[model samples]
Target: MEEFEFITQSADETSILAKRLSEKLTRRDVVTLEGDLGAGKTTFTKALAAGLGIKRNVNSPTFTIIKEYTDGRLPLYHMDVYRLEDADEDLGFDEYFHGEGVSVIEWAHLIEDQLPNERLDIKINYINDSTRKIIITPYGSHYVDLCKELRDESISH
Candidate 1:
């Protein structure tokens, strides 16, 4: 469970990072995005969708709780758990976890307990108006390989 730091110079960079991460995605994967307001969670998710071959518009599912986008190669279960007030809100969390798609949750800190044990944790920290410090932590072998590939590219470039 080691963490790797990725610095993003712009929103586009964050999006590119998301796209690259999504390139290696398959079914039953959980990606938990953590950040403050305007930290680019939605931006990253949109990039992920684009990478997954989704042609639909991607937005913050804040009001809807869960947004499903199947236009992509695989199901993209975009979830925003910010609306949950109940600490024990299990509301359809299993649908993404136990389902056939990959789930990416925004404001996942709200429903930390509902997440799977082996997943990817992506955190975005705004360093300024246009800069972000992104950290990726892998909880299993899949993500560990992701981090390794990311690290290799980082080292090469």
Candidate 2:
């Protein structure tokens, strides 16, 4: 239930923060993103992919629901559940959640019941044009430590 807040003045800043976070991620890590439209969820994911050493373009899997990139330091599973009106459907989510990779879910609230008990939840809010407030809530010890490291890195930067 620990929370960390970070303010970004621009998309570039947001990306930098996301990339920093990605460096702390590991296999089976789940990162859930919540925000309104144009809040830069996809932008953050792209930067996270870059940090993981993924060379491919990372975009929202709005229609596909899930996209997998395995050519990185660790596999990246990008999921956008916004289009899933029926969250009851079993899409083998556990396979991804427990897979040897990091899973980044967009609109995770839609599949709240399916999500693991331990995960990192991130809420992005638009403060104004070109500014965003990122609130990170860590639900497990690993995530808590990860946030602490991220905060320490941010401070030393």
Candidate 3:
């Protein structure tokens, strides 16, 4: 698997990377976020939502599990699967995975079996109070191309 590594020196840099990623996303795209507590997963999601043209404030749906935002160019399905570690009940995840929106999942490993085979996996590591290391891995051809484009764009900037 190919991986892209990006080091963000500040929250603004992280947001910039998230927004750039969001620009390439389309409906049915799945992005998984993994990191420790307070690693800026929700902060990155908010920036992604903004890139999608969503005006509403995007927050982690920790209690609700899934939050849908439709004001964007494409609907945004934000999911937090951290609490589903023990539950075996199917939450009809296929519906959202195949839905007409981009799904961004936090703590996705908790429901790894329910996730689609093709998706982008992102791991964020806290480097300092304001710095972070983001690693992106693509699982399918579409995502591979997307990452390549993102890499090219980043290089040109």
**TM-score of each model, paired residue for residue:** 0.95, 0.98, 0.97
Ranking by TM-score: 2, 3, 1
Stretches off by above 4 angstroms in model 1 are: none
Q: Going through the candidates in order, what is the number of backbone clashes in each?
A: 0, 0, 0
Stretches of candidate 3 above 4 Å error? none
Question: Of the candidates shown, which would achieve the greatest TM-score relative to the real structure?
Answer: 2
Task: Give the root-mean-square deviation of each candidate in angstroms.
Answer: 1.1, 0.7, 0.9
Model 1's alpha-carbon lDDT is 0.89
Clashing pairs in 2: none
Write candidate 1's Cα lDDT for 1-157 as tens digits. 5999999899988888888888888899999999999999999999999999999999999888899999888999999888888949568788788788889998887888888889999999999988999999999998899889987876786
Error of 2 at 130 (Å): 1.2
Model 3 lDDT per residue over 97-141, tens place:
999999999999888888899999999999999999999999999
Model 1 residue 83 CA deviation (Å) reads 1.3
Candidate No. with top lDDT: 2
| lDDT of candidate 2 over 16-91, digit per residue (tens) | 9999999899999999999999999999999999999999988899999999999999999999999997999999
Model 3 residue pairs with clashes: none
